[model samples]
Target: MSAATAAAPRPAPASGRQARRGGHPLAGTYPLLRFALRRDRVRLPVWIGALTLTTVGTLSSFTTQYPDAADRRAAAGTMDSPAGLAMTGPGHYLDDYGHGAMMGHQMLGFVLVMVGLMSVLTVTRHTRTEEETGRAELVRAAAVGRHAQLTAALCAAALANAALGLLLAVGLGASGAEGVTWGGSLLYGAAHTAVGLVFAAVAGITAQVSQFSRGASGMALAAIGAAYALRAAGDVGNATLSWLSPIGWAQRTYVYVDDRWWPLLPALALAAAATAAAYRLSTGRDVGAGLRATRPGRPAASRALTQPLGFAVRLHRGTATGFGAGLLLLGVMYGSILGDAAEMVEDIPELRDALREIGGASVTESFASTVMIVLAVVAAVYVVMAALRPQSEETSGRAEPLLATGLSRTRWAGTHLAVAMAGGTALLALSGLGFGAAGAAATGDGGLFLDLLLAPLAYAPALWVTVGVTAVLFGWLPRATAAAWALPVYAFVVGYLGTVLGFPDWTGDLSPFGYVPRLPAEEMRWTPVVALTALAAALVAFGLAGFRRRDLDTK
Candidate 1:
């Protein structure tokens, strides 16, 4: 090297302004969007494909099941009541009573909730999740612009919504179901995209507000829940309340009935406004930090936080408590409607025919069994999330530090597993009790509550099997841990949708939920429960053994 060249002049170190000279705040957004797409390739397709195929599958079932106008009119009674309106949408769709109107009134609202969830998670994963894992800081250190990450996240969400909307439109239009037009399908799909975009924007703001990724996701989901509640309340009673909710906007589009395109304007407007606000809020905080300040913790740790079990409790307490309360409320809601079960299904011949197949069970008992399937599936979701907590801990690099201090892998993972199992069982029981209590109050059947409570216990073994499957994935194929979710999704499809959508009986055998006897409807059968329990025990044992030998997610 020439001394003269070295001594002559060293290039000036680049200032922050100089480093940012080549691009605007959203520079590199396209590349980041592509990168985000790559990361979510598997997940995105699973979500879209599952939602689309199953939803379109319903059209055939509805067409075949209700072939005539008379049949459709008869089925219309199912959604005519207050409970029906709250669960579905406005009563106007019942006037036309076409399959398209049916999908718009009932299916559209339900699917929007799911679409909103997908959007929320996508935004949070790209923004808050990256920040939590320290990747945002690293990425920002490059030539990447300040707003690039968030813009890219939102773009990715937009892309997903766009794809979903397209698929829905195409699938429904091609199915040639009565009253399902390409134009109406487009409008229906648009409703989903609009709701999704609003929630995606909501997630963006929440991600900026909450320091923890989980907190951000929870906050956004709470917003989705609130919107649904507001819409339901408004639809059932108060005409004004529906106008306040984005979900109401989607429903008010009235696809296949009036096909009112104007209602979607407010949803789109909200999405735009929230997105702008999210961008503005991002400026108030530094990369990897939240706009909302964190409260200081106790100077000393609690004794309970000193052990693996206690630490796990501390980590999972908020989510567990929140979900438990939710399950109980859900159970109560289902129970309240149980006493009116006969009245609810009397005019709907399809339901009456379906119940007749159960032969001896009363309509109310049959109804309770159906409700239990849904409640159990929800409980399974909670358990899966809780069971996957250890993987979250390990991937965050926290597990290694704790393990370094003489903590055995099995003990730590086992503690989390224990929490998952116990929490799942408790959720089902709580929901069952609530269902039973509400049914008893509504129907004047005092014995209902006890029956319901004991009924959920029948599902405990099946939920444990889910936990064990999750454990196996986390233990051996940690990278494939997300696949554990397929179990619950499959269970939901077969257990609930199968019954309603006329999926073949053989399909039920494919899910663990099918093996268990539906509570209160059938006599208690210990053999299946016992067999499931033994399978769970074996799977759990094998998973733990694998975890004991495998390398941790962190060094």
Candidate 2:
């Protein structure tokens, strides 16, 4: 008929033994979107609450934390260095030194990165993950269209991003902060939405290209990390490099200061373009398969695969490898800045005093202690993700076949937990060494390397406690494996901010990580470490008992 109709997707052909499901390529998209939302109702709310509260708390605290123009201007000096620029955004905002500029320049980078992460996981969880677990095949066997699943996933991500953006806009506009306005706040929220949508589209393409769900997420996440680096370098050295990254696009918007809206257009256009490409690519692949076909396995099974631990390792190796490398590099980045740590806050005594209470230590060492929380919390994330993986296996139906052969549930599940434990420890060790080596080089002190390297190991018991919590959830409340993430998130907020902002001591005592002695800055204490280790062992033992008693989720 018309040009528009010609471009539209057609219904299935009415022929063959199987009757055609007569609808467009997006036939079941709305229903699928509703189902996805239903499944993530609790999860989505938690994400929204965390993001909104963090934004509000940080923005509100800025006024009280830096009450005068002199303080804000002095504070801007901390973000002037290359290391500072790499962590924050462009130096343009530093010129104004207002509360809104401070929030936008500092808050946007971290907020967008997190929003991107949430979007990537949401899409991968619904699309490739569902396909890998065979639920996509089952869903497709009904009246659903080929493009319906991916469409629903992207829609769900969009909804979450929209909600986050709305909350941020409302918070900033109504905050009564000196420089924040409704127009600027609206632009701020739009920037977040634009970045998130772009990442969700990136995840859609990655989901189609990767044969496995983890690979899909890893690819998208690597893209996010690369964007951050590119933007940082561009802001510091080359303006042109920023053009290559979506994050740079969002940052250039300069919300509440320049309040530029033109930069967001690129992000929105890229999101639309990538989504179209993902849909086009999906037409060439079958359900449960990817644009990248799975490689043929060796005809014979490896000796390691015959054992439970090896099988578990093989399943986890891809995710662990990617995440571990990222953590190590993050540690290096944090450590490389140690030489400049004192310079950043030299004019602000309040900021410096909160870093640590160590006697006879330079601010540099205290800075290391404050940042160690971020590194340890990141490692704990891996612990939680890997530890709860057994629940994924059980729900996917793969574990049942193995269990039927000769493996008991406890042995099979324990193998997975062992892998998680070893993998988490290895990740922490690599990060520690990276931090130590980088810090030593930056400061030109050989002695610091050994001390810093040994310091992180002290957190291993705290990490084991994280693994134990996940094990407890997987054992008794298998459906509540997602709850394991609560501890790490809480620990990050309390440990990082409380130490920096001089929060109450009991606030630090609430998390398992709170029990960890601030190494190098504080003398190593064995009492808390031993208690945490014992608690972890007890939790793991109790969890194993629960897992043994509970029925597996075959459906």
Candidate 3:
């Protein structure tokens, strides 16, 4: 053939592996697995290490705090209540180091949540998100198989969970407490790993069914939340109900008490079933398409949706509604238990002392205040997420189109910021109402409604600080905005372990919540709240200025 008319480069025979791999599926999964690991190298290590450190710190504290037989028995007394059981796990003998095995009792629920979030986000990010961004199609255009992406996501989750399990085992076993045993540590680790895998599978299934990656993530997280709620309700009321939750299954392992390993079987079964379902579902759908179809919207936009601020509200309404509903339920659940708080304090001197140190006045006040504080902390997450919406919009190229028009960058970003701040504040207020209403109804004390409603407001400034911090990161360091999440995560850690781990008061003070009045227990302080509000406003102003100066990245 002449050089100019050379035979076109021959296409590989679309036969054998190339043709059959699509049918077989999972062919390119190994390479995808490597890609997942590389992407998650830092995130996985941070999550595993943080949880392991918490485990070590908690175990070490128990050894020091309950060294004597009498101390152990006294400590065990606090664990007997329905609320305690709901928060921790089934009761266990506290004497002779059995307590060490149940060290996870204080932290495991949160750890499960963390790991579950990790798994759900991982699967959704790799699958639906890739498809949403058109990256999956590009990858599939290569030698990739049909199911490689989903398989890699699940495998990555499994690997991360397994690594987390090993870390927990080593950390717990090395605590050097007289009650700590290697066998219990191993079982404990295995149970947590199993819990993560179960949620990973749940994520995979949701990813297959939900059209939007966001919807997939939401569904998976909702399932996890529902599981936790079921476990809590069951542990506190009916033991049989607990059987329905994967978290309950893990708790039933009784690692330190009986060292049972059977719970792993059910979790493994669930993981296998879910993964199989996902794979089967994958083959039925087209690339980038989901089992569920997006509902049609109005033919014309509403008058309110025409403006930037209205547009922000329209975008934020679903998220706001979700947060409000979840928090309201949570508040009601916590409030329903306040009647027992006083009795609990009377029965357990250790708990009373701890509450007093943290600013609990009466047991009821102390308990209610603590619960409200926790709700406040959770509310901050909504604020941070909302504040970061502009960043998401910008990166996704949605904001670029708006900014390219007459809309100024400040006006566009400000709209989302308003939603984050105002919506978050409103959610907290709703939470307080839910809590107060439920508590009053339960106790037949109508006076409680006012107290509960006003109490959450005390923490609003702290929540605003989180919103400000996230906005600051989004504006000044768009690429590094993810680091903003660490603030709330760290706040949760400090709030949970500060007193238990004997961290310096100043260390806890790093959390904005640390500055908020403990409310109901202590009289509300205005100075700190005002200072926090001023600081938050300043930060937001500074961030907006920075954002205006920077060029938008359309790519």
* TM-score leader: 1
Error of 3 at 386 (Å): 1.5
- Per-residue alpha-carbon lDDT of candidate 2 for residues 423-465, written as tens digits (9 for 90 to 100): 8888878888989999999889889998878777888898999
Report the C-alpha lDDT of model 1 over 67-178, residue by residue, as the tens digit. 7897788778766877778878988889999999989887988899899999999999999999998888889887788889999999999999999999999999998989
Best-to-worst ranking by lDDT: 1, 2, 3
Model 1 bad stretches (over 4 Å): 1-23, 347-349, 358-360
Native-to-model Cα distance after best TM-score fit, residue 332 in candidate 2, in Å: 1.3
**Candidate 3 clashing pairs?**
97-179
Model 3 misplaced regions, further than 4 Å: 1-24, 74-78, 91-97, 104-106, 343-351, 438-446
lDDT of 2 at 75: 86
Q: TM-score of each candidate?
A: 0.95, 0.94, 0.91
Model 1 pairs in collision = none
Candidate 3 lDDT over residue span 1-555, tens digit each:
689988888877777756787656777889899998998888788878887887788777666656666656655675677766776766643333345645756566657877898888888888998887777999998878888999999999889899999999998877777767899889889988999999999999999898888789889999998888888888788888878989888877767777789977998999899989999999888888899998888999899998999999988887788889888988887777676666545644545666777775466777787787678877888888889889878776778888989999889998888788899889889999989988887667899899998898888887778878887888889877878778777876777556555577887688888888877888878999999999889888878888999988785
The residue-level lDDT of candidate 2 at 14 comes to 69
Q: Comparing candidate 2 with candidate 3, which one achieves the higher lDDT?
A: 2
The predicted structure with the larger TM-score, 1 or 2, is: 1
Given candidate 1, what's the lDDT at residue 444? 95
